[model samples]
Target: MEPKREFFPKVKKTVMPRPYFATEKDVLGHRGTAAAVDAAIYGSNWYLDKEQGLIEIYDAGAAISFFNLLPRKDKYEKEGLYLRLKIAYRTTENANVNLRNFSGNHVTLPNSLTGAMYDDPQTYWWVTDDLTLNINSIFSGEKLWIQRVDWEWMSKEIIYEDELFAKNTILYRSLEEVQKLYSEKELTDDDVKDFLRDKIKNDDWFAKKCLVMLREEQLMGEKLVKLFEDSGLEL
Candidate 1:
């Protein structure tokens, strides 16, 4: 087996729209367009970021090669949407491709101006490494997302597949890949303190809540117990 290359951060550059879906006619006029794009797989309005050029939609058939994971069935009984996305990156002065299959299962699209329009289904659940692929080349990279239905919805429980692969490789998060791309910056005591402070300051609502919980527990003289509890958590 070839030595697996560690994933590097995906470099992003803003660009003008490629004019793929510039008009309603482009979506409705073309024959086989809906099927090609898998419109039925995800509702028409399920993808709301087209106006911002933040997303690009393509037919599922046009993206078969990018689907590194097992393909979901065609039927869906759930209420939410699903989709496949191609995320592109630029590194080494060359654009690289990445694949992500997004089954919009129980995912909500953010309507706020500052919020992202599309949410990855994998974010809520664990994803296997095989579902992610990095393609190095020119012509811009694309992160492909494939959305389809499955059998787990009837139970209302999230599906967790132990053996997951995208593009024939195990899926890894950007954080996991960061270690290989950047040399670890050994931190001094002062640096560690500074980093912790910065992280606490910039943390999101949920993160801040956790911090507050920790502080509250410590203030109640249960710091040692809390520490022990946290220490026992599975990675």
Candidate 2:
């Protein structure tokens, strides 16, 4: 039998009507289009600045990606929003396919945005890795967000199959990959101070990125902890 053609689920992008307090000029050219599309899907006007940070809209959240840790890292960056996602297909005749099979059981990738799946339904929760999300890639006023990753990337073969790999639950993105997306330049002096003073103080999510920014900026030791002081918290 001939192999079946691959199919992928898709979302659409279309020109949005002029948003209130927003114009093509307000959003950075191509980014305006992205924001418009995102707004159409998410039901809120969204945009990003030059440094890839969120300007915010009515309590909307930022878009963060642990890009380097994504399954097909090279593909995502090269293709922009175009993701060629593949599902773990198992046919009874072919049990040795790429992904392990779970015959007579139900297994679905519950929250995977990139479609990483497994055969066993019992292996539900994905363990985490050290790869942190690029917190500054958030956008709201001028640019649309790239996708964000709030969960961890795990490998069952490493943990369940053998003792060859470390018994850790997560995988980490390389330093170079982290810098490319969440560059030091993304966090400005004011942005850093603001994040350290407010966002980090209030939410634990922002803390890791804040520490990365502080180290990147060379705000070492006391200088680092001192920034936290004004936020009315300790590092």
Off by over 4 Å in 1: 1-61, 66-186, 213-235
lDDT of 1 by residue, 57-175 (tens): 32222222222222332212132222323222112222222333343232212222222223344523443333322222122332222232121222223335653442323223465
What tens digits encode model 2's per-residue C-alpha lDDT throughout 46-132? Answer: 344435332222223332222232333222342122222222211222122221111222222232322233323232322123212
lDDT of each: 0.34, 0.34
Worst 10 residues of 1 by lDDT: 26-35
Off by over 4 Å in 2: 1-84, 93-188, 197-235
RMSD of each: 23.0, 25.5
TM-score of 2: 0.18
| Residue 55 miss distance in model 2 (angstroms) | 48
